[model samples]
Every structure is written in structure tokens, then in C-alpha cells.
Target: MNPFDPTVHLPDELLERIRERAPIHDRDNTFPEQDLEELRAAGYLSILVPAARGGAGLSLAQAAILQQRLASAAPATALAINMHLVWTGVAKVFSDRGVPGLEFVQDGAVAGEVFAFGISEAGNDLVLFGSDTEAAPTADGGYAFTGTKIFTSLAPVWTKLGLHGLDTTSPDAPKLVFAFVERTDAITTSDDWDTLGMRATQSRTTRLNGAVADAAHVVRRIDAGPGPDPIVFGIFSVFEILLASVYTGIARRAIDLAVHAASSRRSKKTGAAYSQDPDIRWRIADMGLAYDALPPQIAALARDVDERVDNGARWFVLLSGVKHRAITMAKHVVDQAMLVGGGGSYFSSNELSRLYRDVLAGAFHPSDPESAHATAASAWLGPLES
Candidate 1:
């Protein structure tokens, strides 16, 4: 087998096409179905599955880099695909650890089945540790999940929904059930995805009404509330790293645009290019300084996950910290780019304007500002007294 080359999987021509369509999707506030189809044809959806599983067999680190590149072209497209990659990445984690289960996920991906992440709930800050959804056991030893999932990206096209619900009627009673269910009649995806940015994602609200995950699809049954479950680690690690990659891509795009703007626009006062202006130079340099630190961080941490380097309790701290930093840094870079682009960027038609709105969605993702700070504080100082 050859070393994985991202360009082979995601060529520049494909990225340019996706970039060309990004503005249209954003303007129309629609899902990038064409982008999805193109990526699917490129075998991008199966990038993380093992080679024997008929995938690209790329490492999580490589996937992170590809995602960054994709995001630079179409941020919402990259973000929407992130959910699918998360499941495959988790499957890889299970495979590498010799853990049983999740082979179905790998098989499903190879078979061209789309998986949508269905864990987030409104106002559920416990994230991955607990669930408001109820998981009632069936006679067949499967489970029926009943709850609403928010921010369900790929709602329109996902064939499988990977979700979690709390089981209260079992012998152990109160086990968190992680399972996958087909998108059947029981699932309802609301058409309420209008937003300031990332409109192309179409990440709408999802309602699961007695949605069933058969015994074969039931992957995990563990005690709720913060245990050392590989599923938890898998989701958190892949999710945060990929998310950071997306925002880092946004920052990279913003810097590139700023560079273009600085070079093309000439200052009337000095009759020199804005790139020659000291203020613009400093601003661009500041953006570079901030942006330079992120990709390497994403690469290093993703490599750690791929190599299984044990950071133990610090894993969450590090994961959440990188995500937090990526979003903040990307936002700063985009803001600076907007200023550098001047009044023209304020128009809705400008790409920088779109990026400005798209970057805001990063803050709403998991490990939010408050949660990141809380995690770091607990890691540094002991948990606060009751």
C-alpha cells in the first residue's frame, strides 16, 4: 500500500468546483447535495475506513488535513461531511484497539450508506455523558429511541442515524445506549435551518419517535455520567479535531483573501498597494501569526489520537482546548480580514462577508466557551466545593 496522499483523494479541481458552488448554496440557503455527490464519487466518505474495508485507509491526522483543505474551499460542505467522518473515525478507533462492534459502520460506509450524528439535544450540556432521550428495550433485545436531536447535519440524505438514549427499564437500569437506526418513518426532520451563516449545511432539528435500532445495530450499553468508555473518547476526539480543522481552514481562507485584498487595492494617500501599507502589513502578519499555530496543533493532536498516545485525563482538556482555540483564532483572523477588505467586504456578495458569518457557527459547537473554561479550570484547580 502507498502512503496516503490527500491530493489523490481530493484533487484541486474537485475543490475548485465545490468552491464555485459554495456561494450559490449560501445564497439559496440550501444543502450542498452536489458537493456531497462529488465527494462521494471521490471515495471521500470512506477515507478513514481500513484498506481491507475498501476505503482510502487514511489516518485521522490525514483526514484532518483533508478536511482543512476542503473547508478552505467550502466551509459548510466540510462541516457537513465532518459528521460522517466522525463515525468512520470512531470505527477506526474500535478496529485499531481490536474492539468488537462498529464493523457495521465501516461496512455501511463502504457500501455507500450515509451516517448522520444524532447526539445533540437542546439545552443538554451534559453532552455524551447523559441523554434526555429515552431508550426502551424491546422484546428482540434492541432499543427504541424517543427524543429530539438538534443540529442534525445531513438531515436530508443520511441513511443511518447514530444516536444515544438513556435506558431506564433494563436490568441494570440507566444505561446509556449507543446505537444506529435507519432513517425510517419514525424519524422526522423539521425544515427550520435558516441561519446567519453555514446555511448550506442545512443542519435542521430532528425528532425521533420510537425509532428503532435493532440488536445488531446496538453498539454500546454503559453506565451513564462520565465513565472511561471508548465510545465517548472516540466521539470527543474525532469530533473536536475535525471541527478544529474546519475552522482552521476558514482562517486560512480568510488570510488568503486578506493577502489578495492587500495586494490588489492601492492606497490613494501614498499611491502604493495596501500590501505596502505598514498597518495592513501588521494586520496580515498578525493573522498569519495567529493562524500558523493552529494547523500544527491540529496535526499533532490528531496524530496522538491515531498513535494512541495516552494523555489520560488530559485528553478532554487538550481536545476541547484545541477546538476552542481554533474557533477563536479563526474568528479573529476573519475579523481582521474583513477590516483589511474595507467597505467592499461589508456587502453580502463578498466572500469575506460570508466567511464572517460562517466563522460564528464555530462558537456554537461542542466544548463551548463556558465548557472549555470549566474543563481547563477543573484540570488546573480541583473541582469547586459544593
Candidate 2:
């Protein structure tokens, strides 16, 4: 059986385990180490590593489906695993270039190695704030990476590192490199990531003082061109769509919990279950509508991407619009879920609350709703006035 087969890749028993442990993982504010280990062992980590490198060689859409299912089981673990998947895509982009560090990823995945992304930086409110982590040229045609990366998701558990940054001094450099590093070379600090949601991500700060970046560690030297990367555009589209999928799943779960809560608890006045209440019914209907609307939109966008890839066309406007729409839908659906779940929803024990928080992170990612909206608007109004 193909490891990339969506139906077979994510088995029911694995999802059940994730569902069972997610609550405790959230409460403990620790990384979902065990869940990720299971993912690695199951070959889910190599889903995008390319066929040439002994991977499933799945398309972006298939990977998105896996992420959505995983997110439904455990959003925190899903988010961390998404990073690994994204890095795998990065590694594949460089495989033809004979990048060395990626071999470590492939070998590690075969031997069960976990990787994490270090893009966000400290003293910067926005993640991907030009990467304070600097890479200074060394005497031996290599670079030395030094500085701290904040919000480094899955840092404590990750065995490999994928970093993004620019050569600040040489701003006009033609090439932008996304480097890979081993965990043994860097140090992870004890900085806490006790956020309101996705508490189990362990997205703490990691300080990499004098981490060496040899030629082999450099994954890809992307030519700094005018337009966005086609590969990146495809990846971003997948990511945005899956964010909606996960949010929709959470909303469905919330509705289920609400239904149970209402059925068991009766109001004293009319002796009717909460489910029978008109207000509760209305809220549930709203949740259902929001959940129902997402898949069609995602399908339309996925189809557009496939068409673009076939026609050799890059529809930046359409891609950006899809991202904007999906993120907005996710936020709206999650909010409606919270309302339907009621005050008890705020309690940590209520899984809806955790889902609510994790869903919020989706809107805050790179190519978020606001930026996507801007890109769409820009595309609509023609080129910028020089």
C-alpha cells in the first residue's frame, strides 16, 4: 500500500490515540512529543520528501488532507507536524541541487528524526521579522549562525532545524538561502510558551549561538526574483486550505459536545433539554452553516491550483483570494462554535476552548488574512503606481 494513501496513511487507531492524549497534552503545557513520535514512526513525516529521496512523493493537496485530519485529532501536534511537512517540501526543492543536510532529514526520517522550523525571532512582535538570527561568512566558505529564534515550535522535541533569514549586509544579494542545522549544534532555552491556546506546542525560544552552517547544510539558493515562488505558492495554498479544514473539524466537534451537554442537562423552568431551546438551536444552525460552507470553497481553490499547474499559469490573485477567504471562514466558524458551546466552553476541560485558541493561530500565520487581502486587492487594481 502507498504510504501517501490518505485513507490508509492516517489509520483510525492512530487518530484515536491522538484524541485520547490531546486533552492531557493541552493541560500539561508540554510538547506533544509522543504524538509526533508516532507520526514519524508511521512514515507520515516523509510524505513530502519527494520520490527520489525514498518518500511518498505526495502532492501538496494530499499533505493538506493529512494535516487536516491530524489537526482534528490534536491541533497542537498538527501545527508542529505542519512545520515538519513544510520543511520536507523545502528539502525536496533542494534535492536536485545535492544539498547535504536534507540527506540527514531523509536518513533521520527513515531512522525517525524529528525536525522543527525556527523562523520567528525575539524582540519582534511579528514572526518572520527579517530573522534576527544572523549568518556571518566564515573563513572556510561557510557561515556562522548566531541569535535567538522565538516561538520556535516543537523546539524541545525536534532533532533537526530549518531556518529562514537574509544576509542583511548584502541586502541586494541574488540568492536567498533556507539553511538546515542539526539540533546538537544549537541550545534550547527554558523560555516558557504558556499561551492561552495550543499550550502543548512547546513553542519556546531557542538560542543558537555560533551554530555553524557548512555548504552542505544550505538547502537551496533560491534566486531572488520579482514574483513569488511557484512551489511556495502551492504550499501556501495548501496550508491555508487545511487551516480551514482543521477549524471546521473543531467546530463540528464543538457542536457534538454541545449536543451531548444539552441532551443530558435540562432547564428547570420548562423541563426541556437545552437542545430544545430555540436560541441553542439557532446557534447550532449557524455553526453548521459555517462548517458546511468551507469544503466547497476549499475544493474550488484546489481545483484552481491544479488547473494553474497544468496550464503553466500562476494566478496569484486567485491564490491570495482563496487564502483570504479560507482564513476568514475559519475565524468565523471557530467564533460561532465558541458561542454554541457557551460559557463552559471557556473551561480548559472543554475541548472547544483549546480548538478555539489553536484556530486563532491559523489566522496569524504568514500570508494571513490581512496580507492575503492586500495581495488580492493589489491584483484587482493592477500594478502599483511607481
Candidate 3:
């Protein structure tokens, strides 16, 4: 296949259109359905589904680059779509490793089916290691999931919900079930999604009451706590890397905005552009230095996953660290951009102001500051004496 060129799939014109709609969605606190429609029409929804499976057949690294570009234009749109891409990315992991279960996911994406991530639960810090939700096996090989999933992106339009729960009734007596269920009557999506940033995501709460995943859709049943399961690795690796790409893109946009502000805004004292000011130059340079450090890290790690390079147990640390770094760096760059943007950026209508708000949501995503620190600490210092 030809080297994945992002501009081919996501043209400058398409991105400009999406960028134009971002503030409208943010202001109205509405999902960017038009953005989704354009992306879907452009075959972006199936970018990783493998060329043979009728997709763009891009690697995870390529996907990361594309997502960063997409996020630069409309962060909330990119973020909302990231959930759908996560499942597909996981399916790619399965296919690449000679696994057979997730072909349906690839096919589903090609068929224009939208998949929503439904893993997050309130107060469940165990994350991928455990689940507070219940998963009961049915007479058939399927399982029924009952729980409430918080922060379910693509809540309004997902045709299938991919989620997990704990099954205590089987002989194993405590297995984590990862499965997918169609959006039937058993599932309810709450209308509560108001937030300070990324408002266009419309990532509302999801309630699963006896939602059944047929045998085919039931992907994995593994021992609860973190283990050497491929599913676990696939989810974590793709999720963290893709997430880092989004925030890194946010930082990239901030840098561009800062450059524009510095060039366009002039100081009354010298009647010269802010770009000529020593302090502003230093700030922009600092932002560039910080931002330049992340994409390579993301690309290398993503390439490792793509090429099946075993990073061993350090994989989690690396993934979480990159995500943590990306968000924190993005926040810093946006802060700098706000300063360079002058008092006008403080207004709600300013793009820099929107970016400031959007960047805040990065801290709340997985591998949060606390969890990222905990993972890194455990990796380097070993588990604390308990």
C-alpha cells in the first residue's frame, strides 16, 4: 500500500469546514453530527479496517497522525470519534496478531456502523483490571451486562455499545467479560452531558440493564486483574496513544494561534508586533520545544505496537507517560497562547478562550495525572511496601 498520506484522506478543505463548525457546536453544546457525516462520507470511520476489508488500511501510527491533524481543527469532533476508532483499532490489533474474533468490528465499521465505548464507570479506579458492573452468563454462550457507564461518547448515534462487566456466577466465579451489544431497549443513554469543555462530544451516561451480547459478540472472558491478555494490551495501547495524539494536536493548534497572535498584535509602546518582543519570542519557543517532543514519542510507541515490538511490562508506563505528557504539555501551551493572545482571548467568543476550555478536559481522561504517576512510580520504584 502507498505510504499513508493524511492529506489524501483528510483534505485541507474538509478540515477547514470542520474547524469552522467547532465553535458553533461548543457554543451550543451540541454534538457535531455534520462533522461525523463528512468524516463518514470520506471513509474516515474505517481508516484502520484493513484495505482488504475495504478501509484506508492505515497503520496505528498513520491513524495517530491523522487524528492529530483532525484534532487541530476540531478537538471535540476528533475526541468523540476517538471512541469509535478505539474499538476498530483494537480489532486491528486482534487481526494483526492472528486473532479471529474482531473481524465483525472491522466489517461493521465498513458498513457505516458506529460503535461507542462503554467501559468507564463512576468511582471504578481499577479501570481495565476490574469491573463493578455485573456480567451474567446466559443459557447460551452469551452474557448479559448490567451497569451504568459514564462518559459514553457518541451516545446519541452509536449502533453498538462495547463494554465490560464482571461475571461471578460461572465456574471461574470471577471473570471479566468484554463484549458488544446492539443498542436495544435494554440500554438507556442519559441526556446529561453538560461540561466545561469538549461540549460537542455529548458523552452522556449509559445505563445497561440486561443488555445481551450474543455469543459471537462476546469477545473475551479473562481473569479480572491485569494480566497478559491481548485484549487488555490492545485497548490500553491504542487508547493511550490515540488520546495523546489528540492533545498533542491541541498543543499544535495553540502554537499556531500564538504565532498568529504574536504577528498580528502590536505593542503601543514601540508600535511593533508582539512577535518582536523578547518575552513573547521566548514563550513561543518554549511552547514549540515542548510540543515538538511529543509527536515522535507517540509515533515510535505507536510503531512498536504496529510492528509487534514487545516493550514488555514497560508498555503501560510508556503509554500512560506519553498521554500524561501530551495533556500537560497541551495545557501549558494553551496557557502561553492565552497570554500571547492578550485580554481579547479572555472573552468567550475568542478561539483561544475555547481552546483554553477544551484543553482542560484532557486531565480527566484515562491515565490521569494520579494514575499516570502511580504507573510510572510502580515501574521505576517497584510497588510500594504494603
Candidate 4:
């Protein structure tokens, strides 16, 4: 059976189309342009925007499920689109909290404006803590961002970029300036996207040469590094939860592929299917054991964010932990499938092979294992003693 199916959010036909283009995009190391177009027209870009704002107004719990479904068919497409959704989700998070700062992002989604998250930078382990990009103040009370941003997904076509930088000149020295910059001549995208996997993402390097976010569009100017700001919490909660959903979906698909492989391929000596072998059955069971615990956890935590149930100081730990678990589960399932299916699964053209490569990317996303452990340790045992 096909692992991806029509859900309340995305139609089966849409999933089929996305599935079809995924391979071609991966083969060419190109962005999933077709997938983006389909998702945009399906009103998917507006799923997290408020209903009053001309959108479906989906909860984080609901979006997580839809993302998983989408990811099962094409992890790269799901992951690239995830960047766009992050901004919309952030907008909703603020609106839900009576903060209307990101209302423009909601409005942009309704009008088919693609927003790409651009917080990642070279050598910035601080994540949102700080930015090397310069956020120079303008005479009109806006900021001009001039620095490089890496791993900028949707680089070729994003209409607006949601980014942050360090504002050192202002009296609020070192405040991280969060704003939206429209794509224009000032921004340049590098063609250096070659990678090990998830090539369809085409997350190229972006250089912002005085890319300006006007006064009206600058959203936050809070002190950088981890803080009590709602925007930071909103970004961490939504990004990590949805990220976990994507990798979890990859594992779900790998399990299905393993089951199919076992059922059809016969063992020469026994004259029976691999599925009949006790060892093969056990391997499949192991995959299920790992995959089963994630969805409910993802959904429950997502709902917690939606309902504003305060996890307080534990929020970072919870989000990071879930992300780490999802990636680990996906990689384990793919590895087992490789062994279960034997030599055929080893081919570069094999779906499981591609998945194996794509799953490796999970380790690099924010709140990585070391950071997750550090956050959890700090939450439960306090910071390290000097």
C-alpha cells in the first residue's frame, strides 16, 4: 500500500503529484518548484493563519499531522515547504498571544507570498541567540541587513525572507532585529547547493547586501541569546515540532517499504517470502516499536503549544528532545529496511537509499543532540559549574 494517502488537508491527487516530482527534483538537485505551486493553490500556505485572516486556521497539532502525510511522499518537498510554514505558524503564535506583529505574514500567505526563514548563518552556534549579519538602522526607523545567511530554503522563489541580525549601533546595543525583507536586487543567491541528500531542498547560500526591511515590517528587536521573548519560544516550539513530524514521516514510509519488500521477495532455500522468516518479522517489529511512540508525542506537544499550556523552563528541553527522538527513529528504521531488503535496497536509485540519505539531515537541524542534551541538563540539573 502507498504510505501517503489523502487527508483532510491535502488531497490524494496532490500527494501523487508531489510524489511524482520528488524523484525528478532529487535527481537534478533542484527545488521542488511544482510541489510549491500545488501546495500554494491548495491553500496549504495559509493553514496556520487565523480563520478570520482568510485561512483554514489549523492548529499546530493538525499541521503536524498534515506535514507527516506530506513528508511520507516526499521528504524534501515537505522539508522545504516547512520553512514557509514556519513563518506562518510564527504569525499565528503571535496573533494567538494578542501580538499582531506578524499579521503581514498571515496576509502574505493569503495572497500567495512565500516566506522563507533565514536565521541560519555560518559559525553561529547561538541559533537565534545572535547573528553575524549587520542590522544597521535606517533614517526612517527601519533596519538594513547586510551579511550572509546560509541554508536559505526556497532561495530562488521566496517573495519575502523572515530573518534576524545584530543591531549594534542603536542604544539597544546588540538587540537582534527580526524583520521581513522582500526579494530584490540587493539579495544574491549562490549556486552552491550540492549536498549528500535532500537535494530537492536547494537550500542555497544567501547574501543580503543591504536588504532592507522597512519600519512597518520589522517585527522584533529583543535582546538576543535565549530569552523570555514569546517570539523565540514560538519559533522554537513550532520549528522543532514540525521538524520532528517530517523525519517521523520518513520513518513511517521506510517501515511500509520494508513490509512490502518482505512480503514479495521470496527466500530461495525456504521457497517462502521473507515476511515468513522469524528474523525478518522481528526486524519489522523493531521498526514499528520505534515509530509508534512519536506521532502521539508530536501531536500532544503541539496541542500544548496551541492551548498555551506552559511547559515554562522545560519548553526548550521538551522541543529539542522530541526533535532528536524523531530523527533517531527515522534513521534506525531506514537502516533496518536496508538490511531487510538485502542488496536491492543498497542501489542508489532505491527509494530507501534516498531516504537513508535524507534522514541524515535530521542530525544537523537546530537543537541537535548535544544542544538538546545541554538544554535538558540545564533544565533538570542546572548549568555546568565553573
lDDT per residue, candidate 4, 70-166, as tens digits? 9999999999989999999988889988987899999999999999989999889998889999999999989999999999988888999999999
Best by lDDT: 1
Which scores greater on lDDT, model 2 or model 4?
4
TM-score of each: 0.99, 0.82, 0.99, 0.98
CA shift at 110, candidate 4, in angstroms? 0.9
Which consecutive 10 residues in model 1 have the weakest lDDT in total?
Answer: 1-10
Reference-based lDDT, residue 2, model 3: 60
RMSD of each: 1.0, 3.9, 0.9, 2.5
**Which pairs of residues have clashing backbones in candidate 3?**
none
Q: Which parts of model 3 are misplaced by more than 4 Å?
A: 1-3
Q: Write the per-residue lDDT of candidate 2 for residues 124-241, one digit (tens) a residue.
A: 4333324456676557755567888776778787877877555555455534456777776556566578887777778887887777667766655454433355434534555455
User: How well is each residue in 1-386 modelled by candidate 1, as lDDT tens digits?
Assistant: 76767789899999999999999999999999999998999999999999998998899999999999999999999999999999999999889888889999998888888999999999999989999999999999899999999999998999999999999988788899999999899999999999999999989999999999999999999999988899999999999999999999999999999999999999989999999999999999999999999999999999999998999999999999999999999999999999999999999999999999999999999999999999999999979989
Clashes of each: 0, 1, 0, 1
lDDT of each: 0.96, 0.66, 0.95, 0.92
Q: What is the Å distance of residue 239 in model 1 from its true position? A: 0.2
Candidate 4, TM-score vs. the true structure?
0.98
Off by over 4 Å in 2: 1-7, 50-52, 91-107, 122-130, 168-175, 222-245, 262-278, 299-320, 383-386
The TM-score, computed over Cα atoms with residue i paired to residue i, of candidate 3 is 0.99
